[model samples]
Target: MPRRPLLRNLALTAQTVGEHVTDDPVLLALQVSRRLPRAVSERAAGLLTRARGAGVVRALGHEMRGEREAALAALEARRGSPVHRADAALGLGRPDLTAALLEAVAPDERGAGWSAAAARLAAHRGDLEEAARLAARHPRNRHLARRMAGERDTFRGVAPSLPTKTGHTPAPGRVLHVLTNSLPHTGSGYAQRSHSILASLRDGGFEVEAVTRPGYPVQIGVPWAAERDVVDGIAYQRLLPARLAQGQAARLQQHAELLAAHVRRTRPALLHTTTHFTNAVAVEAVARAFGIPWVYEVRGQLADTWAAVRGPEALESERYRLFQEREAEAARRADGVVTLGEGMRDRLLAAGVAEDAVVLCPNAVGGAFTAEPEDRDVARARLGWDVPEDAFVVGTVSSLVDYEGLDTLLRAAALLAPRCPELRVHIAGDGVARPGLQALAGRLGIAHLCSFPGRVARADARWHHAALDAFIVPRRDLPVTRSVTPMKTVEASATGRPVVASDLPALAELVDHGRTGLLVPAEDPAALADALARLAADPAERARLGAAGRQWALATRTWEANARRYRELYARLGVTAPVR
Candidate 1:
């Protein structure tokens, strides 16, 4: 919002929008739907559905809008080129079709019309080197070219260096966190964890405050958001600009400048930033300019997360390769790095973060989760959930995404429906995968017994945990799932609910096989169904596992304990508060 950068940003935004609409209307429609009002969403939807002349645009839009079958059917019915059909199929999540369609077209025959699609396919199917070469051929599409490059490439030499502080005095105890989003406005597990960590640090006597990425709550549809919000005594500062700089690279630079100015004003002694290198790129720059220590929290392997939505092939993609490089770069430059689970610690080491510099700070829980849980039926009634008193409910309260593998849960429910007449699968959360999962449930003929009550409130998280007879963490087997520890899993264990999670390394760290909770093979619906059936049939076994899970959670995972560890870590890093 600074007068100096306003004109430049406006011009860039205009250029970006013009290119976006002209070259990639499919993405433009999706972006408008998410960022704009209802009228625009309707218009965008119509543009795709009625874009009869442009087969590629229509097909891509249909797929992105969660109508995969419609997209594929329309593409198949059309008399489009092989590359056109392949692009549509890929967008529809049909890699098999993409392969088949591409098989008919010679590699040398592919021109600019097919180059972008080929680049994406190569990225998904093979290596980045080839994909990057393919992507670079598309001179008109800057976004696609940048997508294949590393995030550091976007902000190359863009870290802002501010002048020496003059406005505020340095307080050793004051730690400012740079985050992508935060509580109230964004109710993601990421946001929840941010608040908990900030609250923990505040309670531990550090003057902790958070600053969300620029244009955060405002851009995410919270038009009424103020500059500051104090939730549970932990203050969150918003950076709402009238408009964001044009593209990702430009926006990151702008965010860094804004953050640098904030550092000048608040003058914290240490900077702490979480995963996904964007936050780090900005924070690291500010920390350097101010000559203060910074901590990078590797909360998740976000590159692998993006790959999950695509397929296993995406593990070798250009985006994945670039993302990992940037993450490693950020982690290596930090004064210290913190991560969840031993799996993630090993990943950090593998990613080139110094072994001695990184520490394990697993996802943990507190407050109501520390106490005895309410009766399952009582919780259901309190939540106004319609269900039989004797029904055996098995579910999870998590963001419904492809990586979470709720489709596998629905499949398991279908398998258990006939035998376990009292069985109910209630998944509570919302994401891009919800609609597809719901459609899959209906297709599996178990929609009658399944209930997806969307996203739950942060305050009602405990109640949702208690409402289930058993908690499920049926995550897919992927690079991300294997490394990143989920917060909901620990919260579920803490709430005295027997957790049935995938046998990934991260989940294995929380669940002690058959003792604390059940661990099934990832993506195995039959294994999941078998485990759930056993729990449903044996009340005593369920009670025993639940109690053990609670004990394990209390002993190993608590924000209070985590806070002590962090306080100690701060001391070791020379970031502790000075004695009054």
Candidate 2:
């Protein structure tokens, strides 16, 4: 026999043995193929990598690593494989593409994999009955069939049931908020917003209860188990099941079940949830099960955030399409929708949500942020910054993400450094992009002028804000940035600091150009430098903008005002709190 043929047979035997011993058939195949001679191994592995049923595994691996573009490319390369194409389509959140891909397969060739993909796609598309029916046709799809059947049974008889008005005493105003994460675990802007809203609701006399799903404080390595804690007078009930943390689908189903049980016990008058499709889906399920009216608070265009990291081409990818679809579906199903800005509300309206259904509850400042201004010199001293009392300080308290345009800020700082030697930039938040940003600062020769204090504690966040002469929000002009407002900007404005931000709709809504803060063209270091230089040069102007900003924030962006808006929204939905 030819050496190649003999090696191929041996490799296949090893693959079969490996598959029997290990659960990962793809890894086994790759491992076995490596036993062949160099040239043969390379050719065989390359062929197997793009094999009919292997694209799903490869794509999933890429997705797990946050390499969305790579995952899509893997699926795109295997377009001829129905299973791969269906898996890709489903992953992208495109049931239509999945259906099309599966339909293109010959009837005889539609086996377990194709049936499983079809079933999952049906389930994702909110067709649990069809999903269950399709899942039953294949033995391998039994688990998925069970889940689909459970979901169907869970909400089978559920419908919203509002109390009829009687002359009897009114029920306590109680709300159950389902969140993606909370304090002492994650402190992203989403978590901060959730924390602020919960606190405001509680202080406003509504009994607020919050619950977070599994795998929260994601990078913190916390165990998967239930936890209870209170922060700033709001209680959080967490359900972090180990199995749920194993996968996204399992997390959603298990979270819904757990949340429904909590809802039954709490008997909240209404359900409230925020951000990302996952939280909305889980809360929507629980709300439906209990027949409770739910509010979907669209915090940010999460799909655009996910796409921002992947690149411009990601907007056209299946994942982006699915994200938008899921968000729109959540909005359509919710009794009311709340968003961060008018721009976002407009986007939701354009996406077909009823004009009245969407409410604008822009990001607001807590008391700690809007308290009487602290002395900047004292704050700087407390924060351990050794600088001249008159030194020009420009800083931001934000997660160092790419879309934040911190690199652009660094470039701007470098440009201003030549003229303003007393200038210093302090960034007080940490994220995946921090290392790259720091490297960029060093490359720009502004490392000496830049200080990254990592993530500041929420309680201490105001101190950092108070230490700045002018606060900056150097965000890029991305879809997410344009539609979504940043909580930091509100916090900065409330701290009585002038904001210098990109000229985008969302920031522009918050910072009235030249009145509240300076507006600079986005992604332009020169423009940002000019703005920073002008602010650094004129203390009177800075004081003027800062004072105006504080007034604006107090009038429109305080948590007290935000709470009133929510109360009104709830009243419109026939859920009202008793007067204090």
Candidate 3:
């Protein structure tokens, strides 16, 4: 039988659920659509609407037969509703709807809003090739494109899949982190890494106070985060309000100052600032004013970030040059630099910063999942996972992005799928690339051979890690990727999973080719496929590699061990006395 139309079924069910439970149709649609059957999903196309409860109910009840005609005609009815028309066209899966929708679009209309709608429809239909094509064509939709590319990786059986339950809250910490956004809201990989490190610090007995870019329904503030009345035995502080306007930088800065002032009043021994946004800079200025030495975790080449936001023209303009100058000045002025890898440290040194001023704290295993095999097995079993005794389950637990190299894994899976039919590829993440990756798998005819677990919680991250025969990091050789360490590589090693990663120099530091894990050429699907085959043929080699990796993690990478390094570095900068 043809695959069920899960997406269609979901739209219908969600529409029904929305009418019964909530007045907000959009949220209901999102909620109900998630539970729809595959067959229903296909037939329920064009159900997409940003409408309120009434509009959604009306749209869902409308006959699918004349919906396309009605949507195209409605384009003429509304003067400035390209978003509505584009959404309709997307739901209906009509390419012709593009022309009609574009006809009414204003010259200044953000083209991306419409493109996002189209991408959504393509993704819903599991047509990632089409989604990627549309996403890339829309130049302003870089984030959309990146998301789609990442989804493509998941479909190709790469990355850790996250489980979507309600949510998983980590234990509270002693240090308070007053900074910008949280996981999903952050625009870049650096932000994600920063959050991960903060969590690690919390694990190491720091009363970590966190206040994300405020004003979200998701109440991730400290008092609420802590199960006990207090967080890390300290009163939580979350005073900053979420910014309402997108372009009001100066206003946001003023609001950020109030929060920074609160931090200053508290005068925590160590004030860690993560991003270069308004809040971070404010915190830094306050710490400097108080004569507090702050640790500046440099995630990116600031010059590169500035260039990415403003076009090449800004490179020569005084404004761009000034931004770069200030960024350099900030680094020079920072007491101690906490960078991701040696590459960042080397760059800072080359820029004439003193070598001793930098401390390299690449993403390390935080000892979250270092339990015994029986404990891991119990965890996996409780989570409803059934691993075959003989199965060589190779998996990844990362975002399914193009840079993460899901395509390479899919291609490798296709080649390995026939030889090692028992070799199941499990992906533990999701993104816009989902449709593309799924399409690639369908094209490669290995769809049935892959298991997608969506997004899993941090609690279950280790079990997923322990279950894998070999953990893989197939990163593309992008400049952003080259400068960063794959956090999962270290996490997987801590779980004692042998790794098969791309042979990048930064990753080479983590994975010793023959000793710790096998290394494959970047983007070379065939090489990745061959490496997996080699590991599958030799279980003894896999076991040896896994053992070596676990030892390396214990000797060099746990967060408690790393946090002391960070504390010592701060002391050298005259920030505080030793923690002991």
Candidate 4:
């Protein structure tokens, strides 16, 4: 996090742009716009426009101009230096090209960049041992070093190292949380859930505070972030450092030190952190230092989520194997386990956690969501989204990721366009997949009826929820989707909108097949279309289902209710915090 020299910053900017220029054009543009000056951006946009063939600068221009395939093609075709060509090939997802480039040189002769590319190629090919060895070759490459050291630390495990105070009494009912990121800066489901939990707990009268990972919002593109922000009455503490350590083990140790200092100052009775092992490492270390109990919430199958994007075969990869091994290790070692639902709870229990240790606190609604939803016409008018009176709107408000299977919704829209002229598609929210999904809708010839209104701000979420007649959760049948419950779907139901979702275990727990909402086979556009068509045709049935769904959410899924359960669970663990 230290201020870099101008030359160093320039070199890093070039390296970063070159690294993602081919496969992730969006990433390249983001980097350019955020890191470079307007003059620099314009120059980059036309750097190699006239000079043809494959080169990083030319590829940068191609990516800047939104020519993805052409940028990748340029990366794949003409190249000079083995390091540059290898990096380009790796970016293009062509490990074979990287292998060919490296074959001409000795391992000792290959420079740092080539070694890094070789390591990535090895990881892509599932050779984790080779990846590790290659990672160690470039000791100065902090990114690879961090990844390498993370695996080592996960195996060695996180434990207490700092000394405890002789006579420091903790606030009896105080609880401290360690988080990766939080609101006003990040608006992902994770951030929203964290805020809801903290806010509800605060309302329930337990003194609660959250500390983000060291160098957080600052690290994530916000350089002017303050040291603390009180969001909805909960204090979100920041541990901003002038510079983060280089390797994962070092960085984790530094984070633990920073948190330990805060823990000493706050003196909380209990510590808490969510899934994925790194957070647990620091929390575990700090909890042990203070001789206090800690709870680890298993939010999702993070390893499965990581592999879900790579492909089915990625489950066999070294990184995936190590990720699960480490996560289970952390979960088992925690003082208590809290999870979303049955699927996730079972995974933790199967991983060696005792049955009595795990508690289910499913995703729920609170605050604004508990209120009655506005009429569709009223909501549409307020949001400035025009819609005909007869139009039947069906789409989801979610993070538009690939695993969400939004393309399936686009295809279903195409199928329903002819028979149901009033059908309209308005899939809200944003992510890397939005551009691709929009293109898919265009290709299917449903672009005229479909609307990709981009990211819907959290404050405006209720309006979007009220504007739709039926909400669709067309998730792909991936391990991640099957286990991870979505917060938006529950919010939709709480808005009195009937839900139509893939027949997955996690989602099945949320929707009561015939009563609250309908569950269709995953990835089946025809089945999804049929379900939506029925809802569109029968206004009464839609009302019945929507009302029933709202009742179910009210009865079972509320942050206030979840907060009560959390207090009960903590009491069982000897965290005798006074609950109002």
Identify the runs in model 1 with alpha carbons over 4 angstroms from their true place.
1-23, 28-67, 79-90, 94-152, 155-169, 578-580
- Candidate 3 residue-wise lDDT, 351-393, digit = tens: 6777888787777665454554334456457767666657777
Q: Residues 308-381, candidate 1: write the lDDT tens digits.
A: 77776676655677688888899999998988889888888887888988878788988888888888778989
Range of the 10 consecutive residues with the lowest summed lDDT in candidate 2: 157-166
On residues 273-318, what C-alpha lDDT tens digit does candidate 4 reach at each position? 9977889978888888788899999888988887776676788877
Models sorted by TM-score, best on top: 4, 1, 2, 3
Can you tell me which runs of candidate 4 are displaced by over 4 Å? 1-51, 55-71, 79-110, 123-128, 138-143, 150-160
What's each prediction's TM-score? 0.85, 0.72, 0.66, 0.88
In candidate 3, stretches whose alpha carbon ends up further than 4 angstroms from where it belongs are 1-176, 181-208, 214-236, 240-248, 277-279, 300-327, 373-382, 577-580
Which candidate, 1 or 4, would have the higher lDDT against the true structure? Answer: 4
Order of candidates by lDDT, top first? 4, 1, 2, 3
Candidate with best TM-score: 4
Which ten contiguous residues of candidate 3 have the minimum total lDDT? Answer: 220-229
Report how far off residue 34 is in candidate 4 (Å).
11
Clashes of each: 0, 0, 59, 0
- State the RMSD for candidate 3: 12.8
Runs with alpha carbons beyond 4 Å of true place in candidate 2: 1-171, 215-220, 224-226, 245-247
Model 2, CA-based lDDT: 0.74
